[model samples]
Target: MADFTGASTGGVSTIVTDHAALISACAAGEKQALKTLMKAEGGRMLGVARRMLRRSDLAEDAVQDALVLVWRRAHQFDASRGSAKGWLYTILRNRCLTMLRQEDREVATEADQIEATSQEAVLTAAFDGLETTTGLRQCLERLDGATRQAILSSYVLGHSHGEIAGRLDAPLGTIKARVRRGLLKLRECLS
Candidate 1:
């Protein structure tokens, strides 16, 4: 395997040439090609994953997963589309994004549970005609109809932005703004 350490010092062309050859060698199943490629690019790939995940362990796992994906999918790489380096980074990015989205779902689930519990308490108080509930109802009533509906759909019905947008026949951005503004107004009113 050729050493690519000096390629960066040599020039952009040298780096590109080396990366293309390394990718081709890996695709051809050259025994040491994948190992050589990792040696050349692993640290940079890990850095990219670390920045995306913000956790050392998760970043390491993502990089390891991305490497396995690269090895398995080497044959699918098309040099005609772009540089080999870009292709490798694309794989790493996809892995990182997948992990980030999965983490978001887990966090959202926990948050939703907490929100549900709080909402139940609020509803119970409102039904009991508590003074706080009267104040909250007045605040909610002061919001414009569209904004109020958007807020209710999100907090009460647990509808996602897209779902609320679809139900309201409004743009997703519009729904998001309405919900945000509605919450701010409610905060101001309660304060």
Candidate 2:
């Protein structure tokens, strides 16, 4: 999806694969292999970016940028770290996180938004009237499964820290950390 015509003679080839033989062909300077890899994985990349950005247009652009990185830095794909899938996901996810952080930095939050919710009891009450909470739920799914559940119990369900700890049967400190970190992340995302 990214145009590399300005790069060089490397722009002229058509290697098509339903997967990434990119780690192989890329080292050989086969730009077409990169194209093959992108065509195969770009849709999924867009989907991930879409989930993060929640905008089709931004998702498309993010995928375009991600693909450009994939193409240009194809050599960085290391099989030992994992498959092409993991590597690609890491890059796109990082881009999405960076974008989220940038959005936070670039757009000033209203005084109300900047006001941190004071009590655990108020979280559910605050969100109860919000239709956008479903979107918030979806965004929370981006966390690891345990972290996601811990967060839902605390915020969306308004469980007290002790209650969440009891329900999860996790250490109190662990649950607290997860809740603190998860809320911070959700605030970043929902912002």
Q: For model 2, how does the per-residue alpha-carbon lDDT over 67-125 read when each residue is reduced to its tens digit?
A: 77776677777777677777777777777666654654334133114333332334444
Checking candidate 1 for backbone clashes, the offending pairs are: none
Q: Per-residue lDDT for 1-191 in model 1, tens only? A: 23445345446535333667777787788847777778888887776675546567878998899888888888998889999889998888888777766777676456556564554444343334436457777898788877776666444333568857876799999888888888899999999
Q: Clashes in model 2: which pairs? A: none
TM values, all candidates:
0.49, 0.49
Against the unseen true structure, what C-alpha lDDT does each candidate score? 0.71, 0.62
Tell me how many residue pairs clash in candidate 2. Answer: 0
RMSD of each: 16.0, 12.6
